[model samples]
Target chain A: MNPSMAITEAPGLFTANGLTGLIFLVMMAVTLIGGLIACTAERLVRSVAGLIVCFIGVAALYYFLNSPFVALMQILIYVGAVCITIAFAIMLAAPEENKKNGPAGPLSGPLAFITAGIVTIGLIVMAMRAKFTSLPKVNGGSVKEIGIQFLTSYSMVFELISIVLLIAIIGALVIARAGRSK
Target chain B: MSFLTLYNNLNTFLYLAAILFGMGVYGIVTHRTLIGMLISSELILAAASINFMAFNRFTAPDPTVGQVFTLFIMAIAAAEAAIGLSIIIAVYRNYKSVDTEDLVELNG
Candidate 1:
């Protein structure tokens, strides 16, 4: 994110590097705790809250990754649009009074925990073992560069995604409206 | 090398994404309600995006490409969430319940 390549000197506790490290740790904790709550909570509303928390942590992580634009999008599209829509759906469809069914068997409980554990372990091991070759960046991935590329080489895909989004909106309206007459 | 500096390593982000993806998989399989599954699916998508951004930050020859692709992914995910939630709303209207077990009328 900075014009400087890397920090040469060791960071003291309250210096910029040290403070950044602290923030990174906090974001990691937020992400993990939020993820745990999102998956494990029994209430849908609580789970959605957890999702929002998790997305915020992720957006912060994006900022750390040096892409503020994506971070902003993460907040805008996800926390703003998607989660709110889901919350509204919850209000309209599944209310608090409904008899909350527990997760179905065979896939729920200990089996699901084991499955998830195994998968997580496998992936973590793979990540730990793999060697990443860092290639030099050709250009700084700035927001303006992102915009120019979007309008140029990626224009076709961008237009296609927009069209898909349009269709999805119309289709959602029709589908949600169809059952109203009954 | 240090725990505080974990953010600088590519492996750290990779591990984070993997854990999130695993959580999503567990959620999709175990959640009894349609909305829970949809939420889990979003988690999966987020994990994928993180992986892309990590690779973009660390290794890509052209850094802008990953960010560009991630933007498109966000658009697609927004569309999917919109359509999926509407379908859930319609399904709830039809059945009066959104539980996965209650949607077995057409299973024959």
Candidate 2:
């Protein structure tokens, strides 16, 4: 009876579990591949494309992390706004003729690889060694909860950010305009 | 762990953040152009935000704090990009080139 019961339940559980696993694997692959291209691509335009792809994968990761509000904001702010602004900057400043200049020096490539690798290994080791204590969740961390918190608990911060953004816009306009006259 | 179970663990996110940070570092150290450095800096900031969000999800009592902090990061990054790009434009206008090798005027 027990053997027959196990045999019957195994296939049902496998199909139910396998589909979600496959999706997660795909997303992870997207994230890593995007990161690789963003960092290693020779052309600046390809790097920017990689950055967009990576940001999208990150947004998906945020969704998996149980923050749909953050995931949406990630897409809206990082992918939609930031990437476009960067594209504009690239179009305005970088010329194709300069892209032919190869890497800075013979040692630069190896040195940078060593430095980044060391830092990554160190951080991973620290993360593995640290025994973190989980705290109790206070709220559901939903969009409504985040909205309330922004207005009530974090209202001052929200307002300050608005002011900062305003200042940044004015400053950018002033600086960019200054170059136009020359 | 199994394939679909990647998100169920904290270490997975931590490792991902580490790799992202490494990539950012590599970009910053390389790349002759200022705009490329700016992009790399954004990558570093994103890596930091990811770490904060992961800890907030897995450990913190008040998850709102991390969300708020990440929001602040986005605001700051936006400001940084604006200011940096403007500076790049000004630099390009003055120097006629954005390559780091050519911008050295104060070097004695």
Candidate 3:
């Protein structure tokens, strides 16, 4: 049964749709590899590097999702700002995980893997089974439309997030500054 | 649905998000350090955003809503990262280690 969504017939390898699919597969692979490295890397620095690669792949995925502005912001905020801040924290905290010399806990490695696998399988099954109703597009969801909605419909939420971010910055500075004299 | 056109399907994005979420959960459970947990949390957040965007692209009546929501999530993630990293720094300063096991004491 064909859903309402676009499901093109198989295109030849040199066709535009085929090329786009190929690129998407590459991006998907990049994202998974980076996430694997980030999760399993021995060093924090290498993990951060992997996180960077993962964010870039996610940004590309966002572009494929038809929100180029969101994709660009994803790159700017996540890859550029957030990852850089994380790198700086790594330098400052400098925790090398030297203690215990053994596994993190009795139920950490294998148990964690099993738990994650179960959770993933459950989510995938649920998603596959659920039938989502598609509504006709009201607007193009362009950057302009997003801006208008932000200033109009979502103005309160926007302001609240701004305040929350300000508070977080101040709180972070205060927390980091404490016990510095000791 | 052919593999070549998987990008146009909602299920593909959902599956990708699920896998990423699982990886995040695994990272959080297995990681011993605070920063490492923070990194994994970001992955989880990304997974959530992907779900939002995928739905926005395929099912939403007003598509801008999900995009707007994703933008808010990014802001929140940024703030969380800032606060979390700062707390980690403070914890390190007090205990000389950022490992979860080393942070047993509540005192400064």
**Highest-scoring model, lDDT:** 3
Model 1 CAPRI quality: medium
Q: Candidate 2 at A105: error in angstroms?
A: 0.5
lDDT of 1 by residue, A20-117 (tens): 87899899889878887788788899889999999999999999888999999999999999999999998998977864635687546778888988
Can you write out model 2's per-residue Cα lDDT over A13-130, one digit (the tens) per residue? Answer: 2585556546666777787788777777787788888888988888888777778788888889988888889888888888977573335899998999999999999999988888
Candidates' C-alpha lDDT: 0.87, 0.80, 0.89
State, as a TM-score between 0 and 1, how close model 2 is to the true structure. Answer: 0.92
Question: What lDDT tens digits, residue by residue, belong to model 2 across residues B50-75?
Answer: 88888878788888778878878988
For model 3, the superposed segments whose C-alpha errors exceed 4 Å read A1-4, A95-103, B106-108
- The predicted structure with the larger TM-score, 1 or 3, is 3
Docking class of 2: medium
Comparison by DockQ, 1 against 2, better one: 1
Chain A, candidate 2, TM-score of 0.88
Question: Which residue pairs in candidate 1 collide?
Answer: none
Per-residue lDDT of B1-108 in model 1, one digit per residue for the tens? 455566776787888999999999888888889999999899999999999999999888888998998898999999999999999999999999999989999999
Determine the iRMS, in angstroms, of model 1. 2.8
What total of clashing residue pairs does each candidate reach? 0, 0, 0
C-alpha RMSD over true interface residues, each candidate = 2.8, 5.4, 1.7
Q: Rank the candidates by DockQ, best first.
A: 3, 1, 2
